[model samples]
Target: MRKLGTVLAALLVIMTAGWAGNAEAAKGIVIDGSTTVGPIAKSFAAYFMKKYKVPVTVSESGSGNGAKSLINGSCDIADMSRSMKPQEIAAAKARRINPVANVVALDCLAMIVHPSNPVRALTEAQIGDIFSGRINNWRQVGGPNFPIVVIQRESNSGTQETFKELVMKGRAVVSGAETQASNGAVKNRVSQTRGAIGFVGLGYLDASVKKIAVNGVIPSAATVKNKTYRLSRDLYMYTNGKPAGVVGTFIDLPKTPDGRRIIQELGFVPKY
Candidate 1:
């Protein structure tokens, strides 16, 4: 009888330890960086935490900050708008942090103008001129009589980098341009202010503002998937060293149908 009691107590101890281990494994996931990728990351974090019953937190400072946080071991995942730079990758390697990038979504830089503006499309060169302040009047682009109000993302913005690389080619965005923090902010300002032009992610588009076609090319999923959307870029989640635990599970999310649905419905293309 004493022997049986000992065995039962040992079993109870093992069971309690197992449960504790499982609880720790499902604790939480931390994500940070990239305002351009913020909406998508938030969406994924919400869905993932609810589905897996694991807590998750996400923050957006910028892609550079995200990469830095990942290298510093402060975040489980880092959201990014562009691929890692060579120097960033080298830095990560020095810290023994291998950043495995999982492409989660695609976004088109939706160049927006106030609804009152008649300019429905812009050539790439015309856009360059407008943002550079070389063309300040709407009439320069065969539009209204008002002068154009150029809006831009802050310099630290990942979207800004992508825009510069893909469109501006390192030429400075106009000196007096208004700089906003997030895509939503840019959309709101352009929506309410006539003659204002700004760029935002396609997910933020609405009838309140008009999205201009760049070089006669419309921003759409089909165009982006086919590599025709000139201002499109891939959204990424960077995990340190191929990931583990909740981070690893979340990284594999795009492989599921529900994940893909969320990606497309958010106005971004899914990584195939």
Candidate 2:
């Protein structure tokens, strides 16, 4: 009888420990999505974790994957550079997941090139032609004699979709163009390769690459906010529903002064 009692107590203790471990594991937030929004998500996660002592995991596997994670009950937040498409919403509904979009910031898709390239601005048609196979040489756009290396983000990327809609205007990117997985990769490739041209979120811009004007208008916070920049788009975060608890607070951070500062410092335009 004593042996049976002892074994029962031991089982109770083990069960309690297992429950505790599961609770701890579920305490943090999981964020995954666009490389364009990855920097902002990382910054917000750092700030939230430091302030609240909560664990946060952030991944930039592309917006399409992020939506999949949310629908599959894997991630708490989906950081997307573009709004979720209709098919994504339909898929989520089928799985009983209600994906809700939260606007985080504004971004301008900046056309970038190596600093050595002297060409300053491009019209919409010229930009479209360059990305398509029509214009192959840099000299055609009044630049160097080298061949224009067109760099683009992979098909899974929200940035790629936005570029296709806004810049490509229904035209396909040339098959011969190089495809990178992330915004940083595209920036790096353009910065290192002479006569290369690429587009990246405004947050990824730096001295290594020169941002050329599109239609005589340079991309900047002011230009993007005022709707003057042709490539501007709103950044987004999607939750399963109206977020509650830590997820709600984290998504609301952009409305705060500190969050607004962080957004601007990262080269994205704040909501306010």
Candidate 3:
């Protein structure tokens, strides 16, 4: 009788583990990547979870990590501020992961300076010079007489990549520039440090820091849409192949009016 009881207990444990595994297989939608896009993804996750009673998790490591997660089958989707590179695409293809890109929003990579800097605008060339260690003093660009303190995003940032490609013209970011992990952090640094200059997504713009107009153009939807905002780029999500289940549903949700409103409320340009 004791032996039979022990056998029954073992079987019960195995059955329970199997059931839990199956249950987990049907659980949440996992999104990982770009810190610049994390807030938007988190907002969508919250709304989607509330409306559908489905679990959704969002992670903001960096765009590179996000693409890696998608290829590794570790996430349902990867939120990216920049487009996937060919190598990333090829890697996903090798993993039998067909990455399907969904353009969720348009982002303006707004350049920010300390509020008291007094430089209301900058041309693309000036920006490049600043980041490339060419422009070193605020007085050179109609600001206070102080040495410029350059701040930059970490190498993993999608926003950084976009900024380099668009504003830097493929030039390397200057050494000794402070590197921050997220857009919010960069904004905070720029806000607190006078003579400091940094770049962030449009959503991160606020009174603590002043946005510098690019080539006499502002970082607005109108300017971006009209191609005047040179630092604008489309934000995206890449799914391992065509997303099914909750991820697919959530991606499709943004096409609806309610989702569009959510996007707008979060300070992103609505795709729909």
Q: Model 3, 1-272: lDDT tens per residue?
A: 99999999999999999999767755878899998778888988888878998878898999999999999999898999999999999999998989999988788899999988889999999999999999999988888889999999998999999999998887888897999989989999999999899999988877889998999988876777677788889999898778677788888877888878877777777766
Candidate 1 regions exceeding 4 Å error are 1-26
lDDT values, one for every candidate = 0.87, 0.93, 0.88
Clashing pairs in 2: none
> Candidate 3: where is the Cα deviation over 4 Å?
1-26
Q: Which ten-residue region of model 1 has the weakest summed lDDT?
A: 21-30
TM-score of every candidate relative to the true structure: 0.88, 0.91, 0.90
State in Å the error of residue 167, model 1. Answer: 0.7
Residue ranges of candidate 2 with Cα displaced over 4 Å:
1-23
**lDDT per residue (tens digit) for residues 1-272 in model 2:** 99999999999999999999778858999999999899999999999999988888999999999988999989999999889999999999999999999999999899999999999999878999999979999899888789999999998999999999997888889999999999989999999999799999999999999999999999999999899889999999999999899999999999999999999999999986
Model 1 residue 132 CA deviation (Å) reads 1.4
Clashing pairs in 3: 98-241
Candidate 2 or 1, higher TM-score: 2
Tens digits of lDDT, candidate 1, 1-272? 99999999999999999999767744688899898788888888899878988877889999989999999988888999888989999999999999998888888798999987888889988999998889999998999789899999987778888888888887888899999988888999999999899998878888888988888888888888888878988889999877777778888888889889988888888876
